[model samples]
Target: MKKIFVLDTNVLLHDPQAIFAFDDNEVIIPAVVLEEIDSKKRLADELGRNARSVSRLLDKMRGEGQLHEGIPLPKGGVLKVELNHKSFIRLQEMFGDVTNDNRILAVALNYRLEQEDLAASGTVTAAREVILVSKDVLVRIKADVLGVQAQDYLSDRIIMSSDIYSGYVTLFVHPAVIDEFYTYRYLAVEALQLPVQLNPNEFVILRDEMGSSKSALLRVSMDGGKLEPLYLSNDAVWGITARNAQQRMALELLLNDDIPLVTLNGKAGTGKTLLALAAGLMKVEDEHKYKKLLIARPVVPMGKDIGYLPGEKDEKLRPWMQPIYDNLEFLFDTKKSGDIDKILMGLGSIQVEALTYIRGRSIPGQFIIIDEAQNLTKHEVKTIVSRVGEGSKIVLMGDPEQIDHPYLDSISNGLTHIVERFKGESISGHMTLEKGERSKLAQLAADLL
Candidate 1:
């Protein structure tokens, strides 16, 4: 049956192309949603950009037919800008104020009654299902209270968090396979006789199936043809060494020049930012592989502009970029105040940037790190990653479980989305660090609190 979907303002803000997502279904945009989108179209953030995009899309569709009556969507759905259902009589007693959310609810509730009335009168065969689509949890709950079927706009959401790829897997093999891996220092992928296919640059732990302790740690070749030994040296990066197996895997991906894109997922205190910075510094300063080290993070929840802060651009970015400064100071072993800043000024090879300015710029031959990446949306991440030019490496690291974006969750955030989407590509690699090496107290707090 063809269902009628009433879209909330947030759904359009979260994704401008959400109108075409419901296949062959009648999608109704509440007039209040348009008002909200119009209100946001003047800002200079991701929300404002999305609001403008939605306005353009709606205007283009208006040329085909009057939006109030209805129009055929290119992707097999009918879209209509609902204007007659603004009456708040159905919700006046339950929700006194004629707020925007209440007005949206009234539109959906009126649609439901109209559908039922037509069905009861035999004007139509049966009532079409009316579903309210929104990204807000409280809005969905309130929709349920008003007896409207509601669901999240999930077109951009990736898989569940539990099934997300962890970059490494353990394979139980015969004792001979482990011995061969050790003797040759590399093994053919066919020798494993695996049941499932491994992704490019995926780490593997070969354990003896004969109940022996013999094992070998290796990684799949970028072409997935061979299991090669890790090329990592015993030397520490920026005075930091991997304390756990997953951290070691993260370094392997981080240090490899062939893999231009790396993603790290971990809980707080798992050393995600530290490892990324160490590898970036080693590549930019020591190896001279990249021209500079550029770091960025979202001044999150959109519209929290660094422009509102005092001083120059660098001074404005200091607060949001303090975590990066701490990591850099530790790497440089700075004991005096303002020493790291002087070192950065003297080095002239490192740049700390805001995520706001990263858009619409081509970044090439730089070791780029995006901290707190989980706070970004998929579109924002796409814009950032697509800006990478020739001879550059971009590392996106963050704690997916600790996202603060109002419209994004663990699976839907830009960090996790890119991790899953790029896991199969040869140019990209991912690692999920499980152990926290910051300190005993910090680890305990992360687990307990």
Candidate 2:
């Protein structure tokens, strides 16, 4: 049976296109929701952008028919602007205030009783299902108390975090194929005899299944034309060698000039930021492929509030960008406490900026590294990528488990979103570093604590 979905304000803010998601179901927007959206429309964040889009969509739709009476939706559903159910009946007594949430609840309750009355009077066959969709957890709980069916708005959410693309696979191929791969230095992708088609640039560990101790680490060619050996080098990248297979895979993409976009995923202490920085320095300073090296990370509020930050841009960013500086110090091998500052001052082409300030600029001829990228939203990531100039490489690295953004999770953050969407593209590559190389204590803390 068709259902009536009462959308909360947050649902529209989370995704402006959410109204069209419910197929063949009537979508009723409470007048309070529009009021809330209107209040948020003047803000500066992504929520404000979504609020504007929602308004534009509604205004465009209003031209078709009267939204209050109900309008035809594309997928055999009705979109209605519910204006009359503003005051609460018993909900006002229970909640003590007719707040926006309670007012929305009143609308749903009013619909339920009206539909039930019509069904009881034989005006309709049966009462239609009424569901309140919201992204707020507390609202859903309150809805349950008020005897309303509520669910999370999850059309944009990725289902499983554990099932995210790891960008590599292990295969136990026949011993002869391994030997041929070694001799020829490349093998046909068709000879993998795999269950499914491998993504371009995906790494594979081919172990000899004949009970022999022989193996080779190969990567799927960019065109899926062949399986080729990795550019595994014993040479250290700014004093850090590839400690494991995943790191080597990460470096292969990092150092490769062909792949312009790369994403690295791992837990803390896995060297995601360090490795990307090392490669960025190599390409920009050593190889001279890019004119400058630009590093930026989202300024997440953790130790103190951003408003409480006291200083000019550089001084204020000292705390958040310290982690990046620490990695740089490690790469530059700065022994003294203030030596990193000297090194940074000497590099005329290096830029350490915040993601907030990096927007609206055409960044080209630079190697850009975005650290802690999991804290970003999809629209934020899209904006960042669009700012990349004609000849630059962008690396997005983060630990999915350590996300600080409240609305994001392991699978829904911008880092994982880019990994999933860019896997098949030739210019993109990904690596998930499992091992923590920071220290034994840090690894233990990450695992157990």
Candidate 3:
């Protein structure tokens, strides 16, 4: 049966292409949603960009026909603006308010009643299902209380956290295979002839199938034709050594110039940021592989924002970039208070940027790191990654389960989306650090609290 989907303002803001996602089902936009989108079109952020994109799309579609009467979507469904359904009599009795959310609910409620009336009077064979689509939890609950079917938009969600790719797998092989890998330093993938294909640059632990203690830690070749040894398997970068097998794998990918994109995800105290910073410094200062080290992160606050911070751009970003500075300080071993600033000034190649100013700029011949990427949306991530010019490597690291964005969750955030999307590509590699090396107390808190 053909369904009718009423869109909330947040659904469009989260993903502007949501109109075409319903597959031939009628899509309705409440007039109140337009008001809300218009109010956000002037801000200089991702939300403003999305609001403008949606407005332009709707304006372009207006050439086809009147929106209120209904217009034909490129898909085989009708798109309409709900202008005449402002009645709130049914809602005033249950919840007396005329807020934008209530107004949107009124539009959906009116549509459901109209469909039912038509079906009962024999004007239609049956009533089409009316579903209110939103990204807000409270709105969905209120909709349920009003007897309206509410659903979350799931077009961009990739997978649950438990099902995410860990980037490393244990493979049981014959004792001789492990011995050959150890002796020759490489083993052909054809020798395994396994059931499933391995992704390029995937880490593998080949254990002896005979239950012997012999094991070899190797990484798959970019071409997936052979298993090769980790180049920096035992090397320390910027005075930081890998404390675990997963951390070693992370460093292997991070220090490799062949791979252009790397993603790392783990709980707090897992050394994700620390390892990334170490490798970045090594690439920029030691190897001179890249011209500079550029680090940027989404500015989503953990709790209520302090609001309108004083000082220049760098000072304003100090609070958010403190974690980055802490890692850099540890790597440089700065004891004095002003030592980090002097070291950064002497290097002349390290730059810290807010993600807000990253758009419309092409970054080339640099090592870019985006931390706390879980707060970003799919569109925002694409925008940032697309700005990577030639000879540049980008690393995105964040714990998917620790997202701070109001509209994004573990499955729908940009970090997890990119991890799943890029896992199969030869130019990209990922690792999920399991153990926490920050401190015993910190690890315990992460696991328990």
lDDT of each: 0.90, 0.87, 0.90
Winner of 2 and 3 under lDDT: 3
lDDT (tens digit, per residue) of candidate 1 on 175-213: 998888788889988866897789999999888889889
**Which predicted model would earn the best lDDT?**
1
Using alpha carbons, what is the TM-score of model 3? Answer: 0.93
lDDT of model 1 at residue 224? 89
- Candidate 1: clashing residue pairs, number: 0
Cα RMSD of predicted structure 3:
2.4
lDDT of 2 by residue, 243-325 (tens): 98898899999999999999999989998988999888888888899999999998873212355678887888888899999
Model 2 root mean square deviation, Cα atoms = 2.5
Better of 1 and 2 by lDDT: 1
Candidate 1 local lDDT, residue 168:
92
Report residue 341 deviation for candidate 3 (angstroms). 1.5
Q: What ranges in model 3 sit over 4 Å off?
A: 160-162, 301-307
How does each model score on TM-score?
0.95, 0.93, 0.93
